[model samples]
Target: MQALPKTRTDGRLPLYARLRDQLASRIANGEWSPGDMIPSENRLAEEYGVALATMRMALKQLVDEGLLERRRGTGTFVKQPAFRADLFRFFHVHDVEDPDGPVIPESRILSRQEVDLPPEVKRAFGDDAGGRCLKLERVRLWAGDPLLFEEIYLRLPDFDGLMSLDPKEMGPLLYPVFLQKFGILISSATDELSFGTATQASAKYLELPANSPVAVIERIARNPVGRIIEYRRVHGRPERFRYRVNLGEQHT
Candidate 1:
C-alpha cells in the first residue's frame, strides 16, 4: 500500500488540515470504500511522525465533514458521501410542512425535556437565555420505511404548547404547527450538508447494513425578525436523496 504523506510545516495551514485534504482526495479517488476501517490515530501519527493531537485534529476535521465515523468501541471507518445541497435557499424535509408533500415521515419522540442550553445551541438561539427550549428527536420514514433520524431543538416561546402535543398529532408539518399555535413565521434557514456513516442506532432504525454510509445535515432556521427558532440535525441514506441548487449571475 502507498504510505501516507509526511507532515508539512509551511504554516499557511495546519498540518492536520493538510492530512485531512489528502485523505479526502484519496477517498474521492475510490481508495477507500464504505465500511472500510481507517488507520488508527496512533498509526497516522507515527506515519506522519507528528504528535497524537495533530493526528486527532485531522481526524476530527474529517468526522465533522462526515467523511469518517468514530464508534465508541470500534475504530474510525469510512463514511458514505452525500449529495451537496445549495445554501442559497431554504429546504425542509418533504412532509414537515408542505401539504402537497408525502406523509410518509413518522416520529418516535425519544425524549422531551427542558435543559440549560449548551453553549453552542444557546449562541445559535440568540439572546434568550431566560427562555427555555424543547428538544425533540424522531426517526423519519419514506413510504413507511425508515429514511432518516432527526433531532430538533426549538425555542420554547415560539412553540408554547410543544410539550402537550402527542407525537402522532404533530402532523406532517412542524412549521405550520408553530405558526398556528404561536404566530411564528419561519422566514429563512441555513444548512450545512456532508457525508457521514450511520450510528449503530441510526443504522438499526434505517435498517441499513452495519457501517453503511449516510448523509448528515445540520440546519438552523430563523424567523423574519432574525431570531433563530429551530436547530436540527438529520442523518439519512445517502443513496436515496440529492440536494439540488440553482445559482444566479453575480454583478460585476
Candidate 2:
C-alpha cells in the first residue's frame, strides 16, 4: 500500500474530497496511465486509513467527472479522451473509385522552425507560454492528392527536440509522437470549424484557388494535467468537410 499524502492541513475539505484530489493528482502527473486499473477501493481505504464508504465516494466523484471508468467485471481504469477521434468523425478522405472505402491521409512536413508565437497562441498557453515555439507547416494527402494544409505550434523547451526530427522518419500523426518521444499525452482538445477564404499559403499547399472558400479548423490541445501542448490550424476544400456530435438521451 502506498502511503497517501495528507490533504492540506486546513481540514476544511472533507476526507473523501481530499482523497479524490490526491488520486487525481497521481493520474494527472502520469503516475497512473490511462488504461491502468487503480488500486481496489478496499485497498485504497486500507492504505489511506479511511472508511470503505469514503473510498467509494472518492472513486465515484472521479467516475462522474469522466476521468475514470468503472467496468462491471474489469475494475476501474483511467479514462483518456482523444480529441483527435473527432477528426475522423468530422472528416474522411473518400476514394473516388470506391467512395465508401476507408482512407488515411499521409502527412508531409514541408518546413520546421522556432518562432515567436502569435497572440492567440500565447493566450492559449497562458503562463506556460515561452519566448518561442516550434512550428511546422505540413500538408496531408490522400491517394496522392493534396487535401489539407496545416500549421502546428508547440511550446518551447518542452518540445525542443521536435524541430530537429526528420520529416522522412515521421508518421502520419503528431499526437502519438508527442506521447512516445516527449512524454506528453494529449488528452483533450477544443476545436472550432468555419468557412474561410484560402490564404496564399493554403492555396499553394492545398492547390486551391486563392480566396476560395475553405473549411478552417482551429484546435487547442492539452495534456492530461491540462497544460496547453499544441495550437494547430488547418485548411481544406469545403467539399470534404463534415462534423457530428453525440448527446445523452433526448428529454420528452
The number of the candidate with the highest lDDT is 2
Candidate 2's residue-wise lDDT over 49-122, tens digit each?
88999999999988986788999988999876543324544566665887765555788899899999889889
lDDT of 1 by residue, 58-176 (tens): 88987886668898888998764331222212233454467564334454666677766766677787666455678887776555776677778888665657888777776755765
Clashes, model 2: 0
The lDDT values for all models are: 0.68, 0.80
Segments in model 2 whose C-alpha atoms lie over 4 Å from true places? 1-22, 45-67, 79-85, 95-103, 243-252
TM-score of every prediction relative to native:
0.52, 0.78
